[model samples]
Target: MANRLECVDVGTEYCPCYLAELNECIVCSQLQGKKFCDCNWKGVCVFQEFVWAGYKAKVTRSTVFTRILKKEEINEEVVILTLKVPNKLARDLNEPGAYVFVRGYFSPSFFDTPMSVMWADEIEGIIKIAIQVTGPKTKFIASAKEGEEVYLRGPYWNGMFGQRYIKGMHNSKALVVLRGIAQAPGVIVILKLIQNKNKVIVLLDKGKVQTNFIKDYIKNSDVTLVEADLLSEEGQEVLKQFIKDKKISVIYSGGSDEQHINILEYMDKYESEAYLAVSNNNKICCGEGICGSCEIEIDGQKMRTCKVQVDIRKMLERKMSRG
Candidate 1:
């Protein structure tokens, strides 16, 4: 009934976890506690076992699909990726806009950073995530081809705020900001939301190309489409105007410090109601909670952003920091 997380330690390796594969083992590796934290697998498993025993969630066959939206010099490493968790494993995850844990290895080519899911297509029995190859773990994920099942175990994290909060937006005009490229978790969130009620989704994107993704979703629905052809002061004002109502929330998918600053000022005017999907930079070493690397304070509570997107805690901090 309650939520839980679990992971299997493949071997006797110390917790200097940095995408334990090769090549990247020496490049910006975390073998010396520079990045990774130790996890008590038994404790985690026990917690999971106590909470949800015989919990049926398995990634039977992960075929790396090449269906991705790529970018040139995609520093954010947004790789449009798709993976499938077994039907049994996915059944328990009835929550829409929730993420299940993945058990897999970091590719030898890229740096170290575990990939995370953005959303689920429960009806199709498929779980999807938009991942960015920022490090070793991600590189492996980006390179993983069709039929290659990655070793992973979990349905660790759920949707943000819960269905009640999401449903609240059902009748309002909302903003979905896309600030990430390549393989970002937001892609999952974006895809699932486009399926929302006709007016539930709002697309706030800049530029000709990026704005196109927003336009397509908006034109199809009655959702308001505000295109920031250029991220200007004018653009910020346009987005700010939409964040005022109670049913409306903003999702910042991609951006720079400048864009973040623009958002900070905008969110400050609104307070706790502002919603932001994690930036592509958020490093999630273990898709499960075993790795505390992705811990981010949301509303003063530390939560794993990879598993937990759509937060307001740090948005306040960011807003205050700018002030």
Candidate 2:
């Protein structure tokens, strides 16, 4: 059997989610219709939570209308939106990998687009998101005025995997690779690493986005920044040398699956033992696991990348093999 997967909502208020009711719980084997408890969860018993909830999922996230406080057009393709939200909600979204489902106020529910939290100011009751206007959903969001309201549903934490490494490492050296619009989420990850006293080095590649929009966010921070084309020979050399020499304990790749696989290959080539974290590139039609849009089969087991934490290396390896 594949190793047990970790559910993002397992111990949160959203515990005993729809998966448990369907005997498809990611953490609790008992809830998976098994006879004995083989779960690795250390928090509240999911099976018991399910039984107590009358075999139903707990109350899920609710949609809230937030007013856009400010909007800055970075380019024709990208815009940064600062939104006014509740202080509690902002605080809840202050962690790395935080994201939310956003849509125009007049748009239908299917127009809801998952957006990464670029920055969250709890004291100010505000959050910023970089919206890349790539499709109809984002274009609609981009058209919203500064004073207009938009629908938001989250405090979602599964935007990236290997979060334990991001939260656990302290006073260590780390590397953050960012490219294109993926650079938005990298801001929060870099801030988190810096807050943990980790010395951070950021490799920035303005992939197809054509502009380094994150420079202003990290300029004043105490991080070593290097701008390069990560797909080029010089960039690959820098990445390889950094892994071979810097003794990096954790590495976060904020880009495509191809970028993650390339980094993994360098780590393997240099025999680096750094923990890897990458953006969840799965097609997430719904932030919740019920959509099945983010589902992928790995090692003969189906996983919802939206909420389940799978091995990052295994996931990238699977993609590499498929290509």
Candidate 3:
């Protein structure tokens, strides 16, 4: 059987995006140049939206200049940026898996770097993101001074897969494992889980960034915090024990591909039925799915990781096979 694919933006106002015009719509078979409709989507029809818009894609997300409210240098390698945006934008990005493309205002569009929404305050009209200075693009962002304006294009919500579980699961227990700078995105995930009334436990490893930057964010929240080196045998034992004892219903892995694989391995070893969600980890040059840099093959289908709702199990299978 063919793998069922879901586009992150399918039912949103951003539906019938540029992909539809190119006959490459992720969820619509008819829009993919097929003669008949065979989409699994039960919401508004993407093809109908495309036709209603006169065979054109709807308006794409616009780039805007946002003022930097604050910048906190966590360490030599990491910085947290708080930007002032519109209230609506902040609210839209308050959910799990939200991310945006950011660049220094004076830089060219190619300098745009994707960063997850670490924290968002709708009432305050502000959003915070953590940037690790890994390369030129991030270095430019890191150099951005306070009170300066930065270009942002987003409200993108596919930073991670398994968003359904993140948004829908409640009154259950969840375990979030975050390492290095990957801890940035884990904040919104934890917040959303907490908002859903789920019992949340976080296993944090500062990894290469070498600082537990998120400590301040969740300190007041009702969450159990465990700091451990996830790569060590002792940490592995702790993780396995948590799975076996906590009876966690959902697990989110916020780290490198190796960490994701490790968590998946333990889940299987314990015969865990917990739902798994992991960071996208794909090269996302364009958040709009136009660049094709984020494309990956899963179950014989090519999917753009930037917008596709990938199955965590199949994604892990592909990663393990590549090793």
Candidate 4:
């Protein structure tokens, strides 16, 4: 029997396309508008999907008792949650920048949601996640009480790259832009980056109260916090000024679509590099590439975020091509 993707669009039982990079059959990817094989044998292709080495070797689906250790309202609109999971699972998630696919009950039915692991403690078997109430599901998660039981699975996506982003901190100057609850992932990313001895500047686009809530995430005294209403003209000016003054090497940003586009545009103009995290795109259902729900348009081609390793190198290539 041949291995195949779990999506319905493909007619064949096995993926006809052979991925030269992984030397594996993959129906989830295509080349030259044909579902056969890649055209180039050398060089990493931006269009190719990336499967985590651990996930490829074996798929682990174990549900452990996830207890809510702490729940606090960061602000009127945002809440932070600390959960205690299995010791082994918590330790496995020590990779600073990875997220997990969480399954929580809202109305007696289990629905899976992806949440970035903001902080984790292997010895204590504890992990923290931030929740912005965008819908009923999020609202339920935010309202979770201490000792609440939850279920979780995964340490998916580019978590392996956390060390690289952390290593990039040697550049001295780093910038992180975060807006509202949508871009909560920036909290953990910024935290790890600052720990590596970089001079960090955080541009927070939120109200004073919400900004304070965001401030709790950045305990580093060396980080400079700039508050601006990201949706206002003044906020745009602040961003431009920050971009102008810094010889920034790495930027990590998350928020609304417009916010990311602006950051991308500025990065292009300044010739700087960045990793823009997107939490709004609903297409990502399974944290694994097995499900095709996470498919979205990237440079006019459909790609899955769960499968794609998003980094500045690939993003810059796409950005430059668009210019």
Best by TM-score: 3
lDDT of 2 at 68: 98
TM-score for each model: 0.54, 0.97, 0.98, 0.72
Per residue, candidate 1 scores C-alpha lDDT tens digits across 257-300 of 45555555666677637455434344456554445776655445
As a TM-score, model 1 comes out at 0.54
Q: List, residue by residue over 197-245, the lDDT tens digit for candidate 3.
A: 8889999998999999998888645699999988899988888888775
Please, what is the whole-model Cα lDDT of each candidate in the order they appear?
0.43, 0.90, 0.91, 0.59
Candidate 4 deviant stretches above 4 angstroms: 1-57, 105-110, 158-167, 207-211, 270-282, 297-301, 311-323
- Worst 10-residue lDDT window, candidate 1: 6-15
| Model 4 residue 157 lDDT score | 40
- lDDT winner, 2 or 3: 3
- If the candidates were sorted by their lDDT against the true structure, best first, what order would they fall in? 3, 2, 4, 1
Report the error of model 4 at residue 122, Å: 2.1
Candidate 4, residue 150: the lDDT equals 77
Compute the lDDT for candidate 2: 0.90
